[model samples]
Target: LPAEKMAYLRSLQQKNKRVGMAGDGVNDAPALSQADVSFAMSTGTDVAIETADVTLLHGDISKISYCLSAAKITMNVIRQNLFWAFFYNIIAIPLAAGVFYPIWHISLNPMIAGIAMSLSSVTVVTNSLRLRMLIK
Candidate 1:
């Protein structure tokens, strides 16, 4: 039931999928554990920390934004990587299969493929690094 409740709450949020739980007592432990990510007070019960993925060193609730920001950055990087991987395969597979031979007879060069692979890495890293400049 707790997990279902958490899932319902997650579905209610827009765009972001992060959930932060604040608890100082045992009753909140189950809900805290059900979140995708969680934070607990340093002075909170041990069960709280055991259930949370992160424990706030100073018990400051404000640090929740930092966690959300990190999650957003990670999601963005994942999207970028997925896009590059999909794009590479979509083009490379057709080329490798000789889909263009009927017209230009052009094929993808191994050198170009290597460049594209390297650029994919660069693009994902650069996009991830941009999170550092984002205001929390």
Candidate 2:
């Protein structure tokens, strides 16, 4: 039974799956090392803290759920930031290159486009800062 847990973790990783393991760190060191994400309790052995990607400061297992939620939110923010960046490039680049002048009789000033592009980056940063509100 002692080895069953690590075997299961290893099997999941070998299958190219995302594996998360929570442990005291000493006995589970090998499994923790193999996991895609590992959580160690603050009260756990020193080896666990060193090996873990995250340490549960409260040493409560339930905190793992909070961490998971934060991770998901962080990933979603990243996706949104990337989408905004790509979208900005797609439209701004064409206008800046004067591609719209022949079709719409509108000539975009490069200076204005540059300002708009910079605002896109600022908006993304402001959006990402929303993550701080989640901490509590």
Using TM-score as the measure, which candidate wins? 2
Note the Cα lDDT for every prediction shown.
Answer: 0.75, 0.87
lDDT of 1: 0.75
Instruction: Show model 2 residue runs off by greater than 4 Å.
Output: 1-4, 14-17
Q: How badly does each model clash, as a count of residue pairs?
A: 0, 0
Across residues 14-50, which tens digit of lDDT does each residue of candidate 2 receive?
8889999898857887778878999999999999889
Model 1 over residues 11-101: C-alpha lDDT tens digits? 7544466565676556667778766667788888898878888888778888878777777777877787788879878887678667887
Query: Model 2 TM-score?
Result: 0.85
CA RMSD, predictions in order: 4.8, 2.2
lDDT, residue 75, model 2: 95
